[model samples]
Target: MRLRNATIAAASAVALVLAVPTSANAATGDFLYKVGPGIPAGLADPASGECINLFGATEANPAFAPENFTSSTATVFLDFDCDGDVFYVMNPGKRLGDRLKLRSVVFS
Candidate 1:
């Protein structure tokens, strides 16, 4: 039947040009930082081939700096001044104030 309808329209035009969405599958952007005891700020400054990724962080070390209350460690530092900073490391026995509560995640 006309070469099977021209081989199914050339395999549906190569599956519609491989499903079109290119740019390496495009869609990359994310930023979020939170802290309760105060100390969490960094975002807004990245354009020049774009680069920034902290990606993970979670803190809730009441006051365990050197007490070694089991485990605790968090980090997210980028740019220093260009914008991006969230560092928390207290699990053993490090006491100061506020009680520390942080949540960070960044990517661009």
Candidate 2:
């Protein structure tokens, strides 16, 4: 009986460890951009290796003047869902002009 109880406890501990959620692999800083003539907005500590569509992006009003302050490089796209041709590649601590508009982005 004692051996069985010890084994059960060990199995429960292993299961608990496996059930624990892991932290996301996110960039350590913000990614700033502008939409139309509005003030600057950005994502704080955005997740890495995922496509992030701009909140208010469209053909008439696209996101522009991107500034990457994260630890990872940022790849911006002209189409939604990070599809279409690559608009530009912004490295960490880099900024771009308004001429570079985008609809989605991903951090690597």
Candidate 3:
């Protein structure tokens, strides 16, 4: 659902919008990218078949895979701060909230 800022009641009031790109890019190889938007909340299980191997990934930092998220697939990416529910994507000018499907994906 696309949530408008509460203060936009006035007709003259300009709505603030954040423009986020629909796609993201991550490097390839050993770097374990923290894939999110999996079925269950939290990092994906390495054993699960969804993880992608980020070439030079590390515990603190990991290589990631780019995702082409659609309306049905928001799959927002976040750091450890997304422990509970909801995460903020730094992309600018985007409206609507897509359920984050956290998945730890590995690639060949």
In terms of lDDT, which candidate is strongest? Answer: 2
Q: Point to the candidate with the largest TM-score.
A: 2
- Report lDDT (CA) for all predictions: 0.35, 0.91, 0.30
Q: Which regions of candidate 1 fall more than 4 Å away from where they truly are?
A: 17-19, 22-30, 34-100, 103-108
Give per-residue CA lDDT, model 1, range 34-69, as digits (tens).
332343433333222233342233232211111112
Local distance difference test, candidate 3: 0.30
Query: Candidate 3 residues 1-108, lDDT tens each?
Result: 123444345422443233434333332212122233332121222222233333333345422333422222223333332243533332212333343232223221
| TM-score leaderboard ranking | 2, 1, 3
> How many residue pairs clash in model 2?
0
lDDT of 1: 0.35
lDDT, ranked from best to worst: 2, 1, 3
RMSD, each candidate, Å?
Answer: 11.3, 2.6, 17.1
Worst lDDT run of 10 residues, candidate 2, spans 34-43
